[model samples]
Target: MSPPTRRSPRSRPSPEAAEPNGTFDAATRQQIDAVVAALHELYPDADCELAWETPLDLLIATILSAQSTDARVNQVTRDLFSRYRTASDYADADVAELEEEIRSTGFYRQKAKNLIGAGEILRDRFAGEVPRTIDELTEVPGAARKTANVVLGTAYGIPSGFVVDTHVKRLAHRLGLSAETRPEKIESDLMARIPRDEWIFAAHALIWHGRRVCHARRPQCGDCGLADHCPRNGL
Candidate 1:
């Protein structure tokens, strides 16, 4: 009889690589809450890193932040904000010039167009003031649920929903808080687990955690305070 074929150890999956699409049960909820509490303790004063004084500023900055860093967006907005003080200013801005100003952020053409269109909507539809509600804000160009959440929660002190940026998405999966891939679904799962009052704070804390410890390429699991609680998904 032929000897049984042996399987290579490389064929076996590692613990982190064998992560399940986690479920949100009662016990899962408790774990999630504990994770949130731990994150809050770790990052007690987490807040939006974007630099903005007004709702419109935050709205524009969030849009620019799509494929760029907050620091880069702030650098561009430093002069951009001063130049365009109101919706009318952006609405009247020369597209080519605006694109040139923000060219370093990448996808400058689309961003400029979105900014101009957003300004027009704010000027024509909302009377030159950034809308307060999520529905209204999402109607503007480049202001999706994530962007609207940032604007409403950070600028207006209204916790419309959690801001699911790349950081939030990554952390949510790693922490086993949500298994869903889409931001909207992940957000729904989070909303169910996290209290409405902590929605904004939770988002900020998760973002900070992702940036500082749970990095995309190599999460600092050794130093992470939440390592014990984290599933270390996709590690």
Candidate 2:
């Protein structure tokens, strides 16, 4: 009889990795709390990185942020916003020129089209003012919770909820506070776990952590303050 199929030694770790031995112990809970406290104190002034001068600017900047870095969006919008001030300006903008202006942000064609379309909607439907409510904002072209959140929070001083992007999703998963990978699911998990008062800042802290320490790839676990508490599972 043929010898039993030999399994590679490396495969032995798979079971160990998935096993939930001590997923959330008391110590882990304490550490999670402490980590959040540290971040709150460390980044009290945590704000959205996108630069904008007005509510409309913020709306435009956020619209330009899809699949793009905040820094890049800011860079592009610096000049873009000056040239196009109001909804009418964007709505009537020459598509090719608008595309060229935001080319650096990636997906410029789609972004420009969305911007123009959203601008037209704002002009026709809402009198050119960025809406303060979630449902109204989402009705615009290319506006989702992430974009609407920026407008509601930064533009209207309303807590629309957390802005969960790639950074937040990865960081939340690595931090063991959430098992879900999708941004919406992760946002829901975070909202359920965190205090409503901290919703705005929690996203900022997570973003800062994701960018600085808990990166999507090769997170610096050794230096991370929450490393001890981190499950680092499925990461």
Candidate 3:
């Protein structure tokens, strides 16, 4: 009998795709397309779940969303946006009051301080507005890859990198698209596999998939549109 053929790294998806969600090995091309198409069918209009009236809302919400759900972040920011419209608003927010308001989001004390600091930086450095570039966004007190991804992708229409949220990180692994365990490493892997053009929306699609069908605790793989294409189908 012939020995089983071994696939090469070039034959596997890149450690990370590009800025747009493109490029993949043969196995992954169809799989990614199927995942994207399903998202198109189910949501049809993939968008950011964090509620925001302006760039600053999205930025602050992204900061607050750390270790929390977007729904909960939105709940906390329901009127938080109306009251704190600019970076300076957060800069001036009474520390205790800010902590109390954002207390439900978890890690309230840290988040509140970061919010105030980020706002202060934005006001001083960028004139009270969020920056458009990743470098600029990262200058904020609490901004990280995930937060920067949100700000760069949603607020500025810039796709510097994939957003590696809990959903993106998990779905990427389950879909056999990336092998990295850490979020930054996974983002790097994805940047090499996916095309640059689809980066922003691709993250959104995977996020929606992770939430709706590919749940963390119990993914509904049986009903998943990409079941056949999913290597981790039973997950």
Deviation from native of the Cα of residue 114 in model 1, angstroms = 0.7
Better of 1 and 3 by lDDT: 1
> Predictions ranked by lDDT, top down?
1, 3, 2
lDDT of 2 by residue, 63-159 (tens): 8888899888877877787788899999999999999999998898999999999889999999999988887888888888888876777666676
Global lDDT of each candidate: 0.81, 0.75, 0.79
Quote each prediction's TM-score.
Answer: 0.87, 0.83, 0.87
Q: Which is better, 1 or 2, measured by lDDT? A: 1
Q: In candidate 3, what are the lDDT values of residues 95-145, reduced to their tens digit?
A: 999999999999999999999999899999999888887777787888876
**What range of 10 consecutive residues in model 3 has the weakest lDDT sum?**
3-12
Tell me the tens digit of each residue's lDDT in model 1 across 1-235: 2211111111211112111223457787678778878988899888888877777778888899989998888788888888888999999999999999999888999999999999999999999999987778888988888888888888878977778889999988888777999887888777767777788888999999989989999988888989878888437
* Clash pairs for candidate 2: none
Model 3 ranges with Cα > 4 A deviation? 1-27
- Please name the candidate that would achieve the greatest lDDT relative to the true structure: 1
Clashes of 3: 22
User: Model 1: number of clashes?
Assistant: 0
In angstroms, the error of model 1 at 131 is 0.6
